[model samples]
Target: MEIVTRADRPDLRETAAAVFKERWPEFVFHDEVPRRYTDRAEKYFGLFDIMVLDHGSVVAGGWGVPVPWNGAVGDLPSGYDAALVRAVEAREADIPATTLSFMAAAVGESHDKRGLATVVLQELTRRARDQGLAHVIAPLRPTWKHRYPTVPMDEYAGWTRPDGLSIDPWIRTHQRMGARVLGTAPRSMVIEGTVAEWESWTEMVFPVTGEYVIPGALNLVRIDVEQDHGVYVEENLWVQHR
Candidate 1:
């Protein structure tokens, strides 16, 4: 199995777009990927850093990015921005390590039950550590995954696991991989029924979630999974690498 990270290449953009296509709904509010990378790319993938693609079929492939994203200003337990903020305020760089948000990971529906998703994620972790980033974070929510079911997806609602893998097995899984769950957080969760359903849910909860103003926010605006071709889910998860 030959795996690769892709960007800027003529042929690879399509593959990159494909990965973004499925992954964005959960994060970016926009329903479609722009024809070209925009300023938003600067926030996550400044250079060739936006996304990663793993080679599967020559023309078609598997992909992921060693992406670093910002967390909500209120997400910090102390109601601060990135961990760096508290570190700066307390004058303790060692206390709060900055976290890069994990926006999305999509293993093609056809490709599920295999270890490719893990491969992409492991590679991402390796890349992040090499870059000297402190940790990886994800605004992840299991039930509210913003992927389109019509398109291909791993489809394991609520904290995805490799096929036939049980949650109890994660103790071993975590050991084998250099990854482990940071801890569990409870937020107003969402479910995938209709865009209207999620929108209504967001309307109910986000106002009270706290006013977080990052430089830019991936719009959590809802679009139907298939009909609207908008984002997939609005759930969140925060992750880290070892």
Candidate 2:
């Protein structure tokens, strides 16, 4: 398997997109903030988007953007949405970014458990180091958090195994790679849609207005049938790599 940047291998863009769509939940594609900047980020910072391919078939991918950071955990962007915004704004204003904030990483379903995620992350970090960035951070979406949607992210992020590693597989992977948890972003990514849209995304019925747990959701989705709206606010843990 070989890893390459999207900029250098634009031919793999379609393969990478298929990997992401297959791994991520359908609702994840509806976030307005990311939808607005994703194209721009790719157009400007394509070097930061990396893909792993096995015999020229995409197996894994990761993407991030450079942002100006103060080197303080408390000053980090509120979450993924804010970080993307900061990156775009900084580029437009001619401000040099000091950090690389990872946005998303995914391994194709057929290639799970092959350590491709670690490979993708390592490549991202290597790229950041080569660029002279001071820090590499990720607003991580815990792999197991969706199973415990009612739990607060701050509390969930604190859960550890007997070996002192994170309980969530995704966070544990980062921890094993020398990344330390910084904090929780309670409102990392927000998804809002009409009641009908929510039902279609989850393939579950939302007959009345109330909080309902849906598959692949890390938090409760509030549905207000009377208002014809449903909203989901996701939380993510912030981790900084050494």
Candidate 3:
């Protein structure tokens, strides 16, 4: 596989978008809000981000931004949406970035087991090092947490395997790469839509106010029929690459 950056190959923008959707269709719903800015040519669409191609087809990639992280995990944003806002704010404030904040890393289905994710991580870290950043921080959407929507994030993050590693595959992978789980972002990404819009997205009817467990949702979405709105606040693990 060959790695190419959005900065060098502007045409890969469409491919990168497609790969992201293919790898994460459900999560992509709320991503549109942040994408509005990150997708711009003058912003994060390039520069520090990159894509991997195998035989002319995109297989994996990583996206991130240099931000003014204070080296304190508690100061990290609680959600992916907030992180994006910080990225935009850093640019606007002309703040010199002291760390690289990774937002997303994806490997296509066809490219499974090829270790493309590792390549993406290496490149992301390499770029951060080249820029004199202290570390790479990630608000990881764990690979298998959606299976247990009712499990609290803090408890879930504490679950470990027989080998003393995190039970979450994504978190485990980060651990293997020398990243530590600093904490959990309780509201890492929040998506709000009208009850009708939620119905359209989930294809499920909400006849009353309650928490509805939708397929692919990492958490129970609150639907208030009276208010005609539904809200989903997703949680993620905060991991730091030193």
RMSD of candidates 1 onward, in order? 10.8, 1.0, 1.8
How close is every model to the real structure, measured as TM-score? Answer: 0.46, 0.97, 0.93
Best by lDDT: 2
lDDT agreement of model 3 with the native = 0.81
Note the residue pairs that clash in candidate 2: none
Over the stretch 146-174, how does candidate 3's per-residue lDDT look in tens digits? 89899988888889989999888788888
Candidate 1: tens digits of C-alpha lDDT, residues 1-242: 55454444446556656654553333343322221233343333432233333454422233222332344434433111222233233322233344444434555545656765566556556666676667654433342233322221123223345753323332334335655444432221222334444445344322232222221122243444446222332223343456
lDDT by residue for model 2 (141-182), tens: 999999999999999998999999988999999988999999
Q: Give me the overall lDDT of model 1.
A: 0.38
Task: Give, for candidate 3, the lowest lDDT window spanning 10 residues.
Answer: 38-47
Roughly what TM-score does model 1 have, to 2 decimal places? 0.46
TM-score: which candidate is best? Answer: 2
CA lDDT of 152 in candidate 3?
85
Q: How accurate locally is residue 99 in candidate 3, as Cα lDDT from 0 to 100? A: 78
Please list the C-alpha lDDT of all candidates, in the order they appear.
Answer: 0.38, 0.92, 0.81
What ranking emerges by lDDT with the best candidate at the front?
2, 3, 1
